[model samples]
Target: MLVKIEGIVIRARSFGESNQVVQVYSEHLGKLSFVARGAKKTRSRFSALTQPFTIANFLCFSSGNGLPTLNQADLVHSHQAIRQDLLRTSYGAYWLDLVDHLFEEKEPNPGLYRFLKTAFDWLEQEKDPDILTRMVECKMMAAGGYRPILHACAQCGSEERRPVTFSIYQGGFLCETCKHTDSHAIPLSDATIRILPVLVNLPIDRLGEITIKEETKQQLERVIRSFLMEHVDIRLKSWDILEQMRKVWAASDDSTST
Candidate 1:
């Protein structure tokens, strides 16, 4: 069966010598795999189209069961800016890894497809990639149906204004009284709780207008990390790579400043 799909190349790995296996999140097909027969060749037709962060339209010969064989690919958008920087590359890889690992195949979710496309666009242009990365993580969790309950206590459902606690396992913010229910709950500031919803609910383009403080960013980052790790329960190899890269960048910065 022949099929056409409009999607972004989330991942690309060499198959053998001249072939490449690509994972794409398409508007029509949520997550699909394609094998580009000669993608590794220097002058291959699909060479440019079969790359991470490249959005394209693909023509494939589908077996209707497993991996599809790529016949042709036409480029739609090349996120070149993201590829130019190491930090951006790592964050892009993390996004691709999360979608590839968590999203189920053949499930058509146009909302998520659009969200991811917007995220890549933002990643390519946005100066504050760290804050953008955190925002995307929150959006991903909500899109995946694990939306954190930030408005009220996750355990007791209290909406009164008071200090709250964050419970990754219990799944949201808990009021002071309900904090005892989750012994592991960590204190969450009123500001952090307020901005949690804003970060997730705000439109992507407007993200530039909002400024996130370093301390607040750290809090959100911790919450996001714990929430994803505890709830999804999956080990992300990309996270390790990002952490290592951060250390290297920090050391390089320190040396330059001295």
Candidate 2:
């Protein structure tokens, strides 16, 4: 039972001293794991193809029951540049971690695979990493059926003429009258409201073209973090590492500002 797959290396772990356990998000197989024999010990052929963020062509053998065993792997593109920069690497790991948490195993979703490929391409080209990361998160959330409501109120289905209250619990915006009654809703800006559709619908490659104010970007980032927490509901270990890095960057930013 030989299968060929095109996928991104979402995760890799050591299997003894000579092999590896890899998890990949494939176009045909959704999220799947493979055991690469001798991929670590002897500088084997599949060495380069097994790293995180490496897009690869894999040949595997399985009984369609459990984790597949890797027979061979051919490197496609490594997105090596993404690993060179600290910020890019952190964001990329965050993106892949989200993907790992959001997706189900062996449920084929070509749309997600393509979306991630585009995202990696953008990151590889040295584009705005944060905006691209947000864009991918937005699109991936939508694909997982947790799409955010921005244009109108999610509660009463009202399309009011002003900024509305976004409720993660209610799953969208609420009108002023409705928001007054609900204690959990948060205020949103019109700019953030208007851009939700574009973020969900546009291609990732063009994400850099979307101009947003710093305040609006903060709002959107908060919204996304809240949304993911509500839906995914798992603490990521990498998130803490990223937060430490963000604080370092924040201090640098503050110094520059002063």
- By TM-score, how accurate is candidate 1? 0.94
List candidate 1 segments past 4 Å from native.
Answer: 63-66
Q: What is the TM-score of each candidate against the true structure?
A: 0.94, 0.92
Error of 1 at 205 (Å): 1.9
Clash number for every model?
A: 0, 0
Pairs that clash in candidate 2: none
Candidate 1 local lDDT, residue 228: 88
List model 1 lDDT by residue over 95-195, tens digit each. 88888777888777788788778888888876587877877788778878878887778887777845477999988888878889888887777678878
Query: How many Å off is the CA of 89 in candidate 1?
Result: 0.4
How does residue 95 of candidate 2 score in lDDT?
86
Per-residue lDDT of candidate 2, residues 160-247 (tens digit): 5454777888777778767865687778788877776677788776777778888987887887778778875767877777778878
Looking at model 2, report the run of 10 residues with the lowest lDDT sum. 156-165
